[model samples]
Target: MTGHDRAPGSRIDTSKPHPARMYDWWLGGKDNYPVDEEMGRKLLAIEPRIPIMARANRAFMQRATRWLAQHGITQFLDIGSGIPTEPNLHQIAQRTAPEARVVYCDNDPIVLAHAEALLRSTPEGRTAYLQADVRDPADILERARDTLDFTRPVALSLIALLHFITDEDGAYDLVDAFLQGLPTGSYLMLSHGTGQFTPKGAAEADELYKNSGITLALRDRHEVERFFHGLELVDPGVAVIDTWHPELGEPVEGQQDFQPMPGFGAVARKV
Candidate 1:
């Protein structure tokens, strides 16, 4: 369900699997229900290294945050912020730059339920959470201004988020809308699932998600890169998530043995 449709205190759906909850299950978090676990297991059967991939994705977020913070960008707007796994985007950013300000937006009620963990910023930093979806960029940007300064540079993070939004859903248009509000030097950090590695398995996974009433738009490398059309890519442009910047963080164990995590990640500047 989209965030606009769900009101505050809305009941969490326990019948079907959700992408956020399933991701939490894959990361070994205890906040997921049986339905999430069932789907997680099913996905695991399809891609046994999904847990490793999840860890790799988290590591990518952490490393990207560090890179942004190190480059003097102290404000962040992370959309599609999933369940707060430890060392979240704010924590990583504030660790590098204590005065950093962050605004997190997510549509999942489950994420809102555990948002307390995401709000614990350092005394010198600030963090706020908004229960909003990526589809509604205007509302998100308006509310985010309470915590972030729109006139200044703000890093926009969309890690592991766009694969759920298909081309028909205006993924590129939504990104442009978000970037349009930010100033020059603002960054867009993204990591999206791709079908380049194993086309057959990706197709099967898409079918499974489609049957479960979820959209899984696994794009190729070229299509994924097109999301950053006008933005200037950072060094090592659009590499596999794990290979983006290995020097920036420790490697996820057994990541090298896997099939490159079936994704692409990159950081780019708006200028």
Candidate 2:
């Protein structure tokens, strides 16, 4: 990782479940608590393909980051960066553009704790982590500037994040705020969880999270597309997560078996 400041970890709440921890649990990681595993397993029972979806989502991120890096976009600002998974944003980007610089932000203290130890940057590249929420775009931008140059283009990644943010929380406005601070050449690369494929299961999952004191606002295709209203979407616009640039990705088991994958993914440019 780069020399960016690693803020001290906040108290981890083991009382209830956090989406990040549950995600870790699904990915076969041991950083989660019993509460997280309980909820994660319940959700898995509802949608057994979740583990497949999670792995496919990571593959999409790798493809998107590689697309950006190969296109000469060297800086990245990834918000809602969950637990430090393997082949992280920097590792993917720096593979093509060795000088790539990345800034990963997340509100969970667990991400900061593990990211600092697990996320490694190439000798020619840099990586940094910020313990912050996506709602605080100004603060994130400020801290990100320590490693990335805002004057140039950056790929603002919101993969598998916005669905957790409700419209009441100003999801669109939050995205606009982040994009506003970036230049014309900048991009918004995002993947959103959706209920379009199976509304009943999605509703059950949403209700379960609400009962667990978590917000799960799964949007449909049109609503997800609305996030990129003012921007220009890349080719095969807003395709299913696994379908977007599949040639750039390796074969993910069950990816082809599952039609549509219950989410949308896209990469759009400011101008």
Candidate 3:
């Protein structure tokens, strides 16, 4: 809610590319505009493995969800949840725990337009969508409480999200604030795009996004690790996205040929 919900069929800006739409395009979804495809193709030229990386990021989310669910964690707060794709977080979590409660937050209007797909939940479980941004964690936590219980252990996921928020934008502070609302035993699952493997490609991609009026703040492994400062990193700490718990899910094709997918992922518990 948070008064960010738009009326059905609200105007969607097609003049430029949006991160959500571009991501949807990369995922081969049909919810994006032509401009998004144009930008996606341009990025693909810079990094041919982007689509594979996108799938790898999604697999990381699912694997982390399964891990949390297997550990008896049922509640989830997923921020910067992009356009809905198959086997969403709730679907992956609720498969193990039927009564899992999930709250998804996103600021993209197009996501709100298709949030109905995200609202579908198992009869025993619950799902809610909040049209909000990660910058305003207070409003997100307040609205998310309608479905998620902060007093209990909740898995907080920020997959492929923080890179859009720079340190100057208080990315670290916002993450700390969100974690502060959860109690002990809660988990933080995050995956961020990094420039470690391909610094020149990253710079070109960042500049391309900047020219398109989008912010792409790719970080290194050490910078990404900073987000999980006080938490206990799970086994294989801060490894490449696809390398973390590959057994929990199927491997993304063409991933083996790429150079570590140019991203990092890890899950940690707030003990």
**Per-prediction tally of clashes:** 0, 0, 0
Per-residue lDDT value at 254 in model 3: 91
Summarize candidate 2's per-residue lDDT along 1-271 as a digit string, tens digits.
4754555647888999999999889888988999999999999899998999988888899999988888889999999989988888888898899899999888887777787643578888888888887999999998898899888999999989999999999999999999999999999999998898899999899999999999988998899899998999999889888889988879688878778798899999999
lDDT of 2 at 205: 95
Measured against the true structure, the TM-scores of the candidates, in listed sequence, are 0.96, 0.97, 0.96
TM-score of candidate 1 relative to the true fold: 0.96
What lDDT tens digits, residue by residue, belong to model 1 across residues 113-147? 88888888888888888888799998989988888
TM-score of 3: 0.96
What candidate 2 gets wrong by more than 4 Å, as runs, is 6-9
Task: Supply the global lDDT for candidate 1.
Answer: 0.89
Candidate 2: worst-modelled 10 consecutive residues by lDDT: 1-10
Which scores greater on TM-score, model 1 or model 2? 2
Q: Rate the local accuracy (lDDT) of all candidates.
A: 0.89, 0.89, 0.89
Measured by TM-score, how close is model 2 to the native structure?
0.97
lDDT by residue (tens digit), candidate 3, 1-271: 1123444555679999998888889998999989999999999999988999988889899999999999999999999898999988989998999999988888878888888888788888998888777898888888888788777899999989999998899999999999998899999999999999999999999999999988889999999999999999999999999999999999999999996688999999998
